[model samples]
Target: MKSLRTLRQAAAIVPIAMGRGKGRSRQALAERLGPLRGASTKVAQLLSARDGEDAGRALEPLPLARLLPVMRAAAPTLLGDGATIGAQGRRASLGQVHRAELSDGRDAAVKVLLPGVESDLRSDLGLMGWVGRRAGRRLRQRFDGVAVDDWIAALGDELLAELDYRAEAEAQGRYGRAVSSLPHAVVPAVIVAGDEVLISTWEGGSALADAVAWEPDKRAQLGEALTGAILHPMLTDGLVHGDLHPGNVAFREDRGGEIVLYDFGATREISLPARQAWRALLRGEVPAWDALLTLGFDAERLAPLRDRLDALAALLFAPFRERNATQIDGAERRARADALLGEHRMVPRLAAPTSAIPMIRTLSGLFTILGHLAAPMELWRVFDGADAPAPALPTRAPGKHVAPALPARLLVRSFGEDGRGVEIRLPFETLPDLEDLLPDSAREPIERSGVDLGALAREAFARGPIPQTLFDDVVEGRRVELRVIEA
Candidate 1:
């Protein structure tokens, strides 16, 4: 067993200082340890060494022994008597999740902060503020006409606010209620306590791989449901889930085809403009050229971004795009993302920007999972439609066994210029069937429906025209297709 002293020491080495560029520092720290054989072992030794006086001094406001008592007191309120505490897992940017049980005698989850975490967070924010000011001065040339200080300050404030479990609990409740009307979606109930501890219900479901292997159509359905329940709130409601990765979502059998969302510590409220950008991208309404320009991304980098976004879109829409629903597995999807990010040195870039970490992590995980499921591009139709309601789970019909049709030809067309078109395809067979896709609850009216493919195609063409000569040929027998003319 790892000693508490060692854990404390290891935690101390984490360098809680703000604005020091967490990405860069972590890399440098990793490199520094390379020359030392068994570096981790040595670090563990130092951490475990019993130096109670020193540890207490370093810990300052909070002591280690006090942690268990604090946790015990808070656990009952959050988890109730049915809850049993488990070993602490790794600490994340927000808090740690421990396996537990509910008062009602069901398995559950609990989140608690490290001793003095609140105070440490406050100090970290102050440091970040100072660092942000300095960085703003140095990067003035690069970020001309932008409010660097304000951006940095906002980031620090965001970090501080995130440390508050109470705030997160409130946000979770608000978001949960917003999507409560939608079926096939689950947001765990938030258990509130004084400022530090949080407890929530835990839902059990199969892994993505298992789901896809069992049913492809259901996998696609899950994708659509997730976008509406989670993504919609983030894009239209100005309340970002902040963490939309697969780990944060679980598949439960009892809920029918609904997804169970876990972890709410990193939830952030976005602005109207950010939401607009999100909506435009999801609908394929934002032209590639415009997206690059708006985000201030370099044109040279557009190819990679376009490729990734297209692939991700297809994955998100797997059910509607791919006929068989079979594609690459989770491992392959991860490898593809890793390769792409590696080629672009995205990891290094990710490390340099602290504020972008959550966003990048979320995007990376989301894209990877989508790719694994081989989701289709058509689901974007659902994402972009402001008024579309969630789809109603079809009632089981007598002897019902209808095979899904191949994706519409028009929906498969590329978005690029004449001759050089980007193919949009999703791997559908790799995902779980529709029956296993969503969590079951009393059926609710579909808050949103599928996308209007015809309107979407027209909009895509309007943003970036294909050659007029190629238009008639592509549009033949298709409800929507690229209309291009030869020069």
Candidate 2:
């Protein structure tokens, strides 16, 4: 009986329905054959899993035959020439991509929504919200924190938006227009119908990992350009590429060594304050908790939370800072990052959680890629010196907004008598220029007099093993620090 049912359902999905029987329901038969619905349900469950072990398990790939029929049915005109399907790469619950040659002799990629994904996502998002709320309540009980209901609500909203390809098309168009003038950055065109189907010009290049493996220098240059493109819009324009992942970025050799960016389904508009926070990070300036309060963060509420952020950042950057004397090997850096990620899989639940997760993941992935390619830390200097060009806002007054001015002096201080170092301190204003501090060469510089201490620290600190003697303190809003340890 089961075998007969399976065969009947498969036949219905094919070019022709083969078997006919009395009292058989087409809807029930179709459901049996349509893996899309099953797969989407599974994906939603995985995504909503409270723990990584439950979430990271992979799902089975759906057959192309089932999807092709749906695509052809929706856009007969586009696929009238009998679409020749190529390789199907990397199947996730959301969708799968195919590399194909269009009948018109153009190389393109087609993305098809998995069967029942839309409906499954809707159900899954609701479940996740419930789980998130429950989790938040538990945390609040244990830690005396408020439930992150707003955050969960924001995530639910974004997830729903992502399920709609039509909305994504509009977003992609907006981003394309914004970065249109920029060189070496590409956003693919989308083709939409009743069911959202996207057709984009195929971007061919080595995966970033492979590119870095082939030529380290080229990887470094690419990393710089990619970082500039990713960060500039966020800091200067208040627009962020919400979904930046290794899979989303492609490297093309022909376009003057360009990095092609794809998938605008998760794009987001950042607030001005968040943009400023990002800029501060790029400049290596850690603003005070009070400053964040001024920008609308609840200081009393976030003071303890800020400590955790500091700890996480320190943990993340420790290798770069403490091991300054040693070379940051790309493979080793990735391994370390993976280990760190493994140690803590749960991200801070915040409003717009989806946006936050992707951005955080992207930052980590980009930095890891850079480290793997041996890209000089100096490449990050672009954000520090000579302000980056901000994205023009259609509504905002021109020239009314300017970047916050850099502080005049940066100071570093060290604490402890002579041998046992207690702490290192740095004043906010005294943060050294990020570009100048990054090591261009593997060799360390020798100490000399009449040299700017900040420059000396930049070179000396580039090599690993931060000295215990160095410490930093702030004075009159200027950056001040004392060094107890030498790297």
Number of the top-ranking candidate, with lDDT as the measure: 2
Weakest 10 consecutive residues of candidate 1 by summed lDDT = 50-59
lDDT of 1 by residue, 1-487 (tens): 2244334433334452224446455434333322221223222212222111011112222223355466667765545454566654423344556667565676666666765555454444443334444444545443421234323333444455666788788888878886776787888787654567777766566655455564666677776676667666765576767655545666654456777776666676654544554455444454433432333232333444555655554443343334455455656655665665555534233212223335444554555556555554334444445534322221111111212333332112222212222222211221122123212210011112233333434433442321111111122222222222111
lDDT of each: 0.46, 0.47
Off by over 4 Å in 1: 1-67, 75-94, 99-108, 116-161, 209-213, 292-360, 375-378, 387-487
Candidates in order: C-alpha RMSD to true structure:
20.4, 21.2
The residue ranges of model 2 lying beyond 4 angstroms of the native Cα positions read 1-60, 87-90, 126-138, 144-146, 191-194, 253-256, 284-291, 294-296, 305-365, 371-374, 384-487
True lDDT of residue 69, candidate 1: 67
Lowest summed lDDT window (length 10), candidate 2? 394-403
Q: All candidates' TM-scores?
A: 0.49, 0.57
The TM-score of candidate 1 is: 0.49
Q: After superposition, how far is residue 301 of candidate 1 from its true place, in Å?
A: 10
Candidate 1 residue-pair clash tally: 56
User: How far out, in Å, is residue 66 in model 2?
Assistant: 1.1
